[model samples]
Every structure is written in C-alpha cells, then in structure tokens.
Target: RVIPAQAALFAHVWLDPQNPPRAIMLQYYRDGWMHRAVWGDYDVIPWGAANTTERVHQGELPALGEWTRLEVPVEQLGLNTGDALTGFALTQFGGHVAWDQVSIRGTSDPANDPLRSFAAWWRSVAGKDTPGLSGELADLAKRGPQAEASVEARRRLLNHYLINVCADTQRSLAQPKAELARLQAERTALEASIPSTFVYRDLDQPRDAFVMLRGAYDKPGEGVQPAVPAVLPPLTATGANGRATRLDLARWLVAPEHPLTARVTVNRFWQQVFGTGLVKTSYDFGSQGEMPSHPELLDWLAIEFQRSGWDVKQLMRLLVTSNAFQQTSQVSPELLARDPENRWYARGPRLRLDAEQIRDNALFVSGLINLTMGGKGVKPYQPENIWEPVGFAGSNTRFYTQDHGDALYRRSIYTFIKRTAPAPFLSNFDAPNREQFCTRRERSNTPLQALQLMNDVQHVEAARELAARMLREGGDSAESRIAWAYRLLLTREPAAEELAIVQAQLTAHTNRYAADLAAAQQLIGNGESKPDATLPADTLASYTLVANMLLNLDETLTRN
Candidate 1:
C-alpha cells in the first residue's frame, strides 16, 4: 500500500499529482515563471482522509493487484494546443510499486478508446470524425459538465469542428416547392385555419422626401429622394430602390481604399490616448483643419489599422505601447517657451480627468464606487433642488429624488442625464451638456470645479466612505493608512512631499475633530451611506478630511 504525503495533511496540491493525495484544488494557476491562467486541477478527494477512501480524484487509479488505466487530461494540467509536453512521473511512498507493462499511449485515431477519444475531442476544435460517437459523446457530456458551453463551442469552431448538425431536421424537412404546397393544402383541409389580421409590412417601395421650409410642421418644399453628396465618394452599392441606405454608406466607409474613414477614426483614437491627435482638430479634417504634424506616422497607423480589419482595441494597443506614448509630460522652461502647445510631442499626455472621472475617482478611491456596468441610468445625489427650476413644461424631469444604496454609488456614466440639467458634477468638469455634437470637450479652469470637489455632497460622502475603508483595511500605522489611501486613489506610491502634506493634514484634522466631536459626527454622516460606527468619531472625521484633501488635489485629478 502506498502512503500519502501526511506531512502535507489536506494540502492544496494545485500542482500535477503523480499519485493521488487528499486535497482541495481550484482554478487560477500562477507558478512565478509561468503566466497566470485559468487552470483546471484533478478533482479534490475527501478532506483529511488518511487511507485512500471511496472518494477518489477524477483521474485516480482503482487500487488492485490487477492493472488499471488512469486518463489524465493535459488541458486539466493547464497545457493547451501546440504546447511542448515532455514526460511524466510516478511516486510510491510505502515502497517501490511493481511495474511490468507500464506504458503511455496516445493516438490520432478516435476509435482506439472512447474515454481518450472524448478527452481529445473535448480539447480539440472539431466535429467528431466518428458519426456513431458524435451524438452519443455530446449527450454524455451533458450529464455532468464543468466548463461553459460557449467556451467549448468556440474551441470547436476554431479547429473546424461542427458544433452540431441537424441531420434528423434536414431529413424530415426536405421538400420541393410543389411538395410544400400539397402538404399545406392537405393541412388546410384537415384543420380549421385561424383568422389572422392583415397588415401592411416592409416592402421594396420608394420613400419620397420633401425639404421643409423654416422648421415649421406645415412648411414643405420640392419632393426629393435619397442622393449621394457630389463632394464625397459615390456609394458602391444600393438596394432595389436604387437609393443608398445607411448600411451601404457604412460598407463604403470602411472599404479598403476608403481614404478618410481610417484616417479620421485613428485620429480620434489618438486624441483620446495622447490628448491631441496628429491633426489638432479631431472633429474636422477639412481644408480649414490643422495639418498633421506627423503626417507620415498618422498615415502608416491608419493603413495598419485598416489592415487589422479596423480593430479599435488593436489600434489602441499600438498607440499606447509606442515610444511616443511613454515619455513623461514634465515640461522644461525652454520647451514651454519654444512650443506652447507641445505640438512636437516632446512629452507624454498629462490631462485632467474630465467631470465623470473626477466624481468616479472620488467614489472609487473611497471604495463606494458600484462597478455594475451597463444598466438603466440612475438618479444619483445631486445638489438639493438643483433641477427644480431647470426644465420645460410637459417634460417629465421634475423630481430630484436621489437613489439609495448601490445606484447612488454607480459609475458616473450611469448617472441619469437630463437635458435642462445635465449631471452637474461632470458638467462642471467640462463634460458636454449635450446641447450640440461636441467631438472634443473644451476644458475651462474654474474655481467652481475646485469648490465642487471640496464641498459637493457626493464628494464629501465619498471622502467619508474612503476614510472608513482606510480605517478598516489600511494597516496599523498612520503612515500606512495615509499611504494606502494615496495608492488606492492614485495608481502610484506617494512622493515624499505629497506623503508629508497628507500626513500633516491627517494629524491636524485628528486634533480638530477630537476638539469638536459633534461637528465630526455631522461631517461623517453627510450622505446616504451609513457611518462606520466602529471607528471613533474623531478618527473617522480626521480620515474623512484627509481623504477630501487627497481627492481635491490637482495631482489626483490629473491622469498621468
């Protein structure tokens, strides 16, 4: 009998096991040298079982004098297609186990063994070559599946395997037009036909248009139809109406040789990442627009982007990883004097995070940011009655009822936007009011922005929440708590100067809050979120003030 590793009693043997030892394993493997990946492990045996119990790991061999087979899935061992696999190992703790016809065999042929074939098929991207096993294997896999169906389906398609074939449906439905007509007639005679309402639906019909005079409802002008503008390139394709639709226009726009489309798209993407496009004016590439500084580089990028099937993410990766994108934005006095706009790209992008980011950062840093992406826009806490005077008659944008719980703390993008009163915090930070099509937001340095960051109810609440997190999660020392807050809010470690300033503020606020405990209570209990009652009122208020100072700093607002 083989003795298990009792030293590692109930050890999480995440690594490949040569012999079965009782342990619980999990996904997400990272051996320092290897890439962190979603790894599969052999099933966990019974917890803390000394003797080889009835509960065996998935690939465990049945203990007996007779020979037995153990099938170990390579994928489970975290190796994928085309990976170099070298050898295996055997371990016998009690004594040297007898080995006679011990051998490992793998084959390309599916018929040799069903279990091996199933594993091969599971890892592979393909339809089964064996017709008999195809349906049976798929059905059997349905009994107890671990992985996602879509994940497996994607693998099959990649390897040219058919996910499924409706052979029975095809055979049963086979019919010509005449056969179908006869069958329908027979069915009509046998069964009573349900009465249906007739209504006009879509058809290939000409839709005429009229030019309206003045924006009046009654005003109409000469009849017109779909026509391409004389200036731009002509549409390459159209429908039966001989009118170019949006789809046709879209198709032509992304066509390989389309000059403006790729250039325009790349330019916009460049602007977002680099804070300025090659052509300064992102919205326009007309004759009025600024000429590209690096025309050659822009063209090359556009061409490459087009070649990659207009892969936006790929293009973004290319831009962000480039040398030009990596430089520090710190400006020298000489360069500042010589190039006011920094058109030469002498430095990297140093931009103030726009309104949404400013508020979101406050929420995120404080550990109050709800990360549920893509849902109905919620009404977050706005200033008391800000929307009261801001609307039109018949507009349903009346109440400024604030959302409680998670909705109140959702990402700023999901904050409900009203036309008359756009989400104020973001709008104050130069986020567009949606009055017009703004390709690029114009930023204005104003006292209003600074004031909002400091005193806004949302921001104040975020500070308190952050203070709570720092109190709970931050380590023992004052320095550690301050450092934790700084790192959490800002992606980097705090500079000595920045750290000193925050530490000083924390000390000052701690003393101040201690002197006025009632004020501290009021300060920490500002918004919808509950106060962290476990924390002392003075400490909570002090941390809140420190967090507030951190959030308001120009360094915190700016994206490095």
Candidate 2:
C-alpha cells in the first residue's frame, strides 16, 4: 500500500536454503517522483536486512499530498524459492496522505512492470514526444466520440503531469531558507535606496503593447502606443525621455485631473467593507454598469485615501472603528422596507461566513486550529473516491488522508486548490474556481449543504471534538458546559434562555441514553467511535439525531 504522508516502515529479506544464504537487500523506488522531499534514492537500509525502518520523505517538511507511488523489489531482496516475502511496512505519518496501490513482483526487468510502464509513459509525455500522444488520440478517435474525448482528457492529464514535474524541479533548485534570508536583506537595502514618500516621476522609458486578435497570443494585431484613453484628456508627457511605467500610471490614476480612477478604487474599497459600493459596479465604473448610489461619499473616501498616502490600514481603522460599522445587523421592519439589501449602512450586514472563515471557525471552536501561515500548500482531509474522473484510466489514483497534526489545522486559504477537484466543504460554501480571477463569490443555501453539515465525516468529527473539549474545560455542571460551548463556537456567552434550552436538551439526552453510556459518550467525545448498544439503541439514535439537527441549524452556519 502507498504510505500516507511523510514516512513509513519498509523492508525485504531473501531466504536461500541451499548454500550459505546471500545477504538480504531492499531497494525503495518511487514512481514518477515529482517532489524530491517526498521520496529518497538508494539509501542503504538503516536497519539491517529484515527489519523495518522509518523511511521518511528526504526532509521533515510536509508535502502537497500529490499522488506518488513507492515500490519495494521483493525478489532483489534475496529470497530463495518458497521463502515467504513479507510486504514492506507503512506506518501513519502526519498531514493529509494518500496511498495508491501496493504490489510485490518477482521480475527483475523494470520495463515490463505496470507501475514502471505508467511512470515511463508519464515521464515520456513530460519529455515531449508529440507522436505518442497524437497516435493515442488518433486510435481513440477511430473508436468513437467518447473515446476521442477520453484521449483528449488523457492528453490533458499528461500535460498537467509535465507542468507539475517542471515546477517541482524548479522548486528543487530554488533558494532555501538561508537564501531567502539573504534575499530579504538585499530587498531591505533596495527599499532603503528608494524614498518611501510617494513622489511624482515620469516613466523612464515608453512602453508599447499589442492587442491579441481574438485574444490569442499567436495572432497579434498592430502595436498600440501607450497613452491615456480617448475619453480622458491627453496625458502631458514629461521628463527628458518620455515613458509610461507604474509611477506614471499611479500618478494618472489619482491625479486631480483624472475623473474615474480615484472614484473607482474608493468605491471598490467601500464595497469590500460595506458589501455594496456607492456605485454597484465597483470594478467597472464605465457607462454600462450601475451608477453610484452615493457619489459624494465615494469621492470623499477617494480623496481621503489619496491624502493619507494610500495607507490602507489607517483607512480601515477609521472606517471600522466607527460607530456606524459597530451597529448590530438586526433589521427593523421599517429599515427592511426602505432598504432590504441594507444599502445605506444604517446597520451592519448579516453575512454568511466565507469558505475560509467557515472552515477556520470550525477548527477554532474544536480547539484544533493552528495559527501557522505561509508555506507550500497542504491537502486537507477529503472524502474517498472524490478524485474519480481526474484520476481516470491510466492516471495515478489519489488517496486523501486526514491531517491529525499541525498541518491539518492551517487556515483554509493555504490549502491546495485543484481546478478539477476542490475541497468539498469549502466548495459547498462557494469557494472560487482558482482557474479564473474571482472578485466576488456567490452565497448559496441548499439541502446538499445541510446534508454535508449533518453527515460529512469531518464536520461530525469536529462537533464531537468540540463537545469533548467543552466537557474537559468547563466546570462539572450543565450550565457551565453550555456556556463554554457557546463561548468557543460563537465567541459569546449563551443567552439565559439559550443556556436553559441546551441544558435541558443535554439532560434529556443523558437520561434517555442511560443504558447506552458507551454510545452516548461516543456521540459527545472527539475521535471516538460511536458505540453500538442493544438496550438504548433507539435512545442513542434519538440523541445523536437531535444533536446533528442542532448542528445543521441556520444559526450555526451564519456569521451574524
């Protein structure tokens, strides 16, 4: 079996009964090894012949949980005829891991091996032999339309493998931590050379760009000289040699003479904070989009942003620290009648948490969140068989493992995103398709979402874990536990009525499932299996059903 995560135990030994037995040898080889840290080459078995050693991916740093294959040559390990060959040992390693498939083969020729063949085909595509791909596609096309599509899909898969290999190789040669430190120091020196205060400067050189005909780089149109748009006044070129760089662009963007730039940016920022900008189309302030609802307020903010030297932190402090932002989201019928969308910012917006915030909040309440940032992406726990079409015929299968350690608990933004496959929980909550630029994501509610909250293994596990944490940290009383649960999950103490309601529910559950203590405990405890019981099966079932219902309530999902 493929060992999940970083390390595993592996070994092989041969038994030759005839003459003096030959010394045993075990060789570990990875198929299509993309990340160097995930596998090792020809290290002498640290433990003598037959024993298992903890085989780590070359470094302690975690992996991105890509599909990787490992192999142990059983025959080469020196086994005589009729000697038993124990498959290598693979132990649990931290972080999301996946094991493909394991095999023990007797052959010495790597060319005939299935995994080696698959790996070779992969590497061959990466190496770029168009004939192989074309031939396969042609054969597939002759079969039927579906076959042709399959061939094209395979080609895409091969292309992705090529990109990943190229990327991994480049990363391998890239600067390590020491090099990064040196680079940072160099950057600091460079910044010191330049003045921090914004200054007006002409571009050093003129820049020219060409429009792509039909948006294809292969079909370029005539070159267009850099100049302000025709609708705006002509730019007054300045300095010894006229040019247009970001400095010129920034100047033009906020120049007192420029009409749209400041207004657009200010409106966009306002939209970010208030959910709706003065102008509905923040990005497109063009004639086609929605007109500003409060043009004067937008202009005021724009002027402020420019006057403050574009210090975003200061602007945020001034805006959010104000009483207007602090107002509760509770909407009076009068306010709702006048502005159902809450356009005036008379009250805060009642919002559903973003995908990242939702996952982070879940882990935070479970006491399992790790406040780490900035590194290679880690794969979070996902359901089995989720990577079906992506790993279809001839491609390596991906197995997802639960991350039990620090890596599992990182902020959701840092998780790896695949265009073809995304983390299920986050996707349900409207995480974007990273294949394209996304300014805003849609918020949706559906039965599927409720099903996920109620039945998804991860959410269920998190709830149980949170319950156990409350039991441990709270005083030994129902009221205290109820209050603690609210504090961790909602960041506030439960209201008196809420506390009473939850306490009553807990008591009812406890008494009802008295004969099934094991099951009851499992329902409340983290990482514990739900126990099977004879007498209180129905009662245990009832309590669990109710607990799941509470977890699925609308209040649980909404941030407000």
Candidate 3:
C-alpha cells in the first residue's frame, strides 16, 4: 500500500496494570529500510538497535489499565506521500498488550465531502438554515480532518447532517417513521388507560416435578408434587384435574391452623414500628433461628392479626394504641444495664429513623413536600457525576439530571432509584441500592451522616425554608421564634435552659451575619426555591443556622 498525504495511523490499545509492556514499538517498512517509533516508560532505550539502518522515534508511554486511542501522523514516522508501505508491525517487549481498530485514515477535502454537499443542496432547496446548524458546519469545515478535529465535533457535524439535511431516502421514510411513532404512542396510552392484573392458571398438562440430585437441574432423582410441608397441616384442596393447585397452596399458607404465616406477618409489622422483631432473626423461622423473646405475646398478636382478616391498617392501629407501645423510652441506669438492646420490651421504641423517613421528615417540617399522589419516579438532588463510573455509556440512566420545582421536593418514596448508583444522600444514611431483596437494613452512625444533614442541598434548602416559616409565622421576639421552632420540630415547648441556649446561638449568628451580609446571602442561596426577599437576609440566615441545628438534634431524628 502507498502512504497517503496527511494520513495518520491510530490504534485502540489496552495495557495490563499489574504487568504492562516494557515498550510499544510501531515499525513501517519503506524503501528497503525499517522506520520505527517507540513509546515506553524509560527516556532512553536499554537495548541497542538490531540494525544500523533502523530509524527510531522514542516517546513516553500512555496511561495503563485502560483502553486509549493512540494516533500518530505517518509523516512523523519518516514516510513521504508517494512512499510504498510494504508492511507494518506492532511489537511489544515483555508483559501483555491488546490492540484493536488499527487503521490509517486520510484527510478529506471539505468542499468535496458528502455531508457538506448535502447541506448545500438542502439549503438551496429549503431556502433557509438554522444558526446553530450553520455554525457547526462552518466549524467543521474550518477544522478539517487534517487539522485534527475532535471526536465530539465530528459527532455534532454528523448529527446536524442527519437532522437538517434530508436525503431522498430519508424523505421517503419520514412519513412511515412518523406514522409508526404515532401508533406506538397510541398503544402506550391505551395500555396506561386500562387496569390489568396478574392471575395464575395451571397448565393443562403440567410438567413433572423432580427433585434434582445435588441441586443439579439435569440430574433428577425422585418425583415430587405440590403440597404443604409434612410437619404442618395437609393441603386437601384440589383443582378440576384432582390435583392440588396454586389456589390450594395459597389457602394453606393463610389457613387459621397454619403456624408461620400470621406469626411472620405480625412480627414484621411489629419490627416496622419498633426497631427489632420479637423473633430477632426475621428472615429465618426454622430451628436455626433465634426464638421469640415472648412466645405468648407473639401468639396473641398473630391470632389478632388473623382475626382482623389480615387488615394491615387495623393491625397498625391496634399496635400503636396499646399501652406497651405508649411506654416512655427513657430508661434508668439499672434498666439500661439489664437490657441494652431493649429485648425485654420494658420501654417504647427509640431509634434513628430510616433513610426515607429522615428525608421525608425534613421535607415535611420545611413545608416543601409535594403531596401529589401516584406518578412516575422523580430525580432529586445528588452529588454530581455519581453515576458515571458505574453506569453504561448508552444507558438511559447513565446521566443523573436533577429535576426542578415539585419533583425536587417529592416524598422519598417517589425518588428514582438506580440499582448501580442509589441516591447518595439516602445511601449515606444506610438506604439499600435495591439490587436484591433486603429483609433488614443495617443502621450505622458516622460523621458522614451528620455532614450530609448539614451540607446536602436538600437538607440545607429545607433548613432555609423552615427559617423563613419561623420568621413570618413566629412572633416578633427572638425567644418567641426559638420557642416556635422548638415546638414545630419536637412537638413540645423548649425547656428554660434549652430556650436560653438557643437564644444565645441566635444572638451570636445574628451578630456575625449582620457584620457579613455576603456570607449570609451565600448561605441562604442553596436550593431552587428563593428566599423571602421581604425579610432581612442576615436575620433569615441566622435563623436558618439555628433551624439547621434543630433539625440535626438527636431527639428530632429519633422515632420516640
């Protein structure tokens, strides 16, 4: 092959991180001589040249452990436009290297390019061109392939050519594409407008059930049938075929005589309200699991749950209204020593709220929560580029675009979840990514959780909104405002000492903000919502700090 003028040779290469190649060498045979270019970690070569006629160009190595496109102009490798390139070789010394897409590309004249010609024809036929499209064309022409235009610039030019310059084939297919899109949209609308549910039906000729030998599906040993465990009650119900069906299984699970279903359901609900279930191992009910701390209470609750027809709301009401649930969480030193984990149920539930509850609580107190019911998931504030590393390039969820207005303030239940990259604010507080079923979430207390409360955009904005509410609705004096916030956050009036401490904090913040209004404005300018322009910035900012402090208090976060 003959070398073309203004052509560059490029190859996508990946080097091993643990054992990278000592050197990468590209050799071109021209005019009976081998011209070589080398890139390696060392500045000078440790080995002498194989032949006196060989020409070498030494360069530095690129990054290791990632695929990178490396390109070099043929002219830089001592090749002329008319030179005959008989062969080329890539050589590596030591370790391993992988290469792909190795080829030579030549510069194309902008005037003769197909895309430019199509654009000119489209402009003459359409009689107009958008400013953006025209600008991209001009930029591409100015920085042609010879000038090494960037990949992004080339992509933009191609997009403009496809969107703005319609060829004969494109014009022919436009109507059909539009019609297909309309039909798809109509189908989607019809699907959403109707209600649907899943119903199980037995096959006419059901497949034989076999017990796999050593859990290998292909190695079957013995046949089996659909029936309850031998230890429990039998499944007597049958289908039209005279065999037990899925409905029979369902009946057996919820039967009044069954031992596990009602007990497990009530225990989970109890765990939801309290921190732990009576049976500490909620996922396991076998002999291997821990026994219930109070067997009689468990039995009674399960019986009551079954009697109420498994009504979850009624069960919740009954539990919450009980005297045991209403007991004070405060414990004496002796009691704390006797039962550190409260396994004896001597006190009420007192633990930090879960991730969703904590976020929703903040939004509720700040009055920023949007009470809209039923919609698609929403995107809330999260750290920038949190999804880039774990996300696929062409995936719809690769980019995390924060939503605006009400979407930003929706309940945490409506927050969009990406299995690869869960919301950072929630994850920092122990929210699962939801890749698999989670029976119990592990709670951890760390400085990072406190940092999220004070610094995250959502929490900071919530604090600002709460501050504004306190200023506008609370009484004029500082004491009144402090008392009002205390009541609103904790559902009780502040103690005299607590009130005095808050007053001192407010006074100190007010003096500092009063001196530096710029800092105060910066502090309040956190979220999409604007601060109250009518109120003084310094005063609002001072109160915002105080509100933030109140939101982060242990008492406020605890469930009791």
Model 1 bad stretches (over 4 Å): 1-232, 307-309, 392-394, 491-497
TM-score of 2: 0.53
Ranking by TM-score: 3, 1, 2
Instruction: List TM-score per model, in order.
Output: 0.59, 0.53, 0.65
- Can you write out model 1's per-residue Cα lDDT over 3-33, one digit (the tens) per residue? 1111111111222234433322221122221
Maximum-lDDT candidate: 3
Question: Model 3 over residues 1-560: C-alpha lDDT tens digits?
Answer: 54555888777788899998878876677765456667884424433254322545456677899998878787666676645577777778787899877777776444433434554433332433435555755655444444456788766765666655545446866888799899999999999999899988899888899999999989998998777678999887677667799888888899999999999999898888888998999999999999999989999999999999999999999888988788999999999999999999899989889999998999999999998999989999988889888889799988888899999999999999999889988788888778878777888999999999999999999999999999988899888988898889888999999999999999999999999999999999999999999989999999999999999999999878
Per-residue alpha-carbon lDDT of candidate 2 for residues 1-560, written as tens digits (9 for 90 to 100): 22222223232222222321112222333332111112322243344322223222332222233333444333323333323223433322222333434444343233422133434434333434434345654344234323335655666644543433334433664557458779999999999988578775544554457898999988879897667888896676554456445556667776876787667776666666666777877657787888778778777877888788877887777777767667888888998999898777788856676778766776777666778767767776777777675755654444444555577677887787666778898788888866777666678977888787777765665665565555567667767866766665566787888777776777677676676767665554433344333324434344444445445656666745
Clashing pairs in 3: none
Clash count per candidate: 2, 2, 0
Q: Where does candidate 2 clash, by residue pair?
A: 14-78, 14-79
Model 1: which ten-residue window has the lowest total lDDT? 1-10
lDDT of each: 0.67, 0.57, 0.82
Residue 278 Cα positional deviation in candidate 3, in Å, after optimal superposition: 1.6
Model 3 score (lDDT): 0.82
Give the better candidate number (2 or 3) by lDDT: 3
